[model samples]
Structures are given as structure tokens and as C-alpha cells.
Target: MITLWLFILIGAVIAFFWFGRQIAEAAQQHAVGQAEKLNVQLLSVACVKRRLAVLSNGRLGIKSQFAFEFSSDQQSAYTGTMHLENLRLKKMDIPPHRMG
Candidate 1:
């Protein structure tokens, strides 16, 4: 029973790590796409929030929020936020920024 419990814990950890990577990749892609669409330069992206949340389908799912920095001109930077659910982009917030 102890060994079985250990296996289960390890499996859970593995799943969390695997899904985290996928979420990060999806977040980066979304950030990049948004930046390109806005004709800005993407600087950096980082995971901001992660939790189990109710999705649009009314089911519990892994939700991740990413914060990204972008620059329209080389001298100034702006912040953007993106939310992803189960490796899919759910929403994004980009503030008004100056254009080069």
C-alpha cells in the first residue's frame, strides 16, 4: 500500500510537470501572436497564476495566467496578461501602448 501510494504521488507530479510545460508553450504562442498582430516586439513571458478553476464547460480544469512584456518602440515596454485553460488561450489583456 505504501509503494502504491508513492507511485500515485509520482504520477501526479509527472502529470503536473508535463501539463505545466504544455501550458507554458501555449501561453508563449498566444503572447507572440498577439504581439505580432499588434505589430509590437515581444520581450519576455512568465507564468503569473496557476490554479484549478471552472472552465467554460462548467468543469474543473487547469488554468494558467501568463504575464508578458512587449515594446512597441525600442525604448519603452508594456505589460500584457493572458489566461489559458488546458493548453488553450481563453483571454488576453493588452493595455494601450505607444507605437513606434
Candidate 2:
């Protein structure tokens, strides 16, 4: 019975480590995914001369500054500046020429 208890304790420790590692890996993957999503969304907005700056405003937010250049002699629409957080929680529309 003593040996069995020891075995169970060791098993619990192993399980804890395994679970912790999985959680850590998941968090890392989530951050990477968010960054990629933000990049895609930024590109989709017809953004030219785009710049991204990260700021810690209690939450991680991306500050974007860009202009939409026009080729048809039309006035270019400049977004001027924008901030985005919780990228996965939002749907974004980006112009096709900028996305590719």
C-alpha cells in the first residue's frame, strides 16, 4: 500500500509538469497567432507606408499609422492613425491589392 501511494504521488507530479508545459506552449502559440492576424488585417486595409508600434496600455495594443495611396488621381485616404487590441475578437476588411 505504501509503494502504491508513492507511485501515485510520482504520477501526479508528472501530470502536473506535463499540463504546465502544455499551457505554456499554448500561450506562446496564441501570441504568435495574434501577431500574424494583426499583420494580415493591417495589410488588408489598403495601407501604404504602414508602420506598427506596440504599446503597453494596460493591454497590448498595436498603433498603426498609414496612408492609402490612390492611382487614379483621386485623393488618397489616410487612416492617419489607429489602435487595435484583441485582434482575434474583430473582423477586418482590407483592400485586395494590399492583402497580396
Query: Scored by CA lDDT, what does every candidate get?
Result: 0.91, 0.37
Question: Which parts of model 2 are misplaced by more than 4 Å?
Answer: 40-100
The most accurate candidate by lDDT is 1
TM-score of each: 0.95, 0.37
Error of 1 at 31 (Å): 0.8
Native-to-model Cα distance after best TM-score fit, residue 30 in candidate 1, in Å: 0.6
lDDT of 1 by residue, 1-100 (tens): 9999999999998998898998898888888889889999999999998997899889988988899999999999999899888888988988999989
Cα lDDT tens digits, model 2, 14-48, are 96566544434443344345436544321122222
Looking at model 2, the pairs that clash are 44-94, 44-95
Q: Which candidate is the best by TM-score?
A: 1
Error of 1 at 27 (Å): 0.6
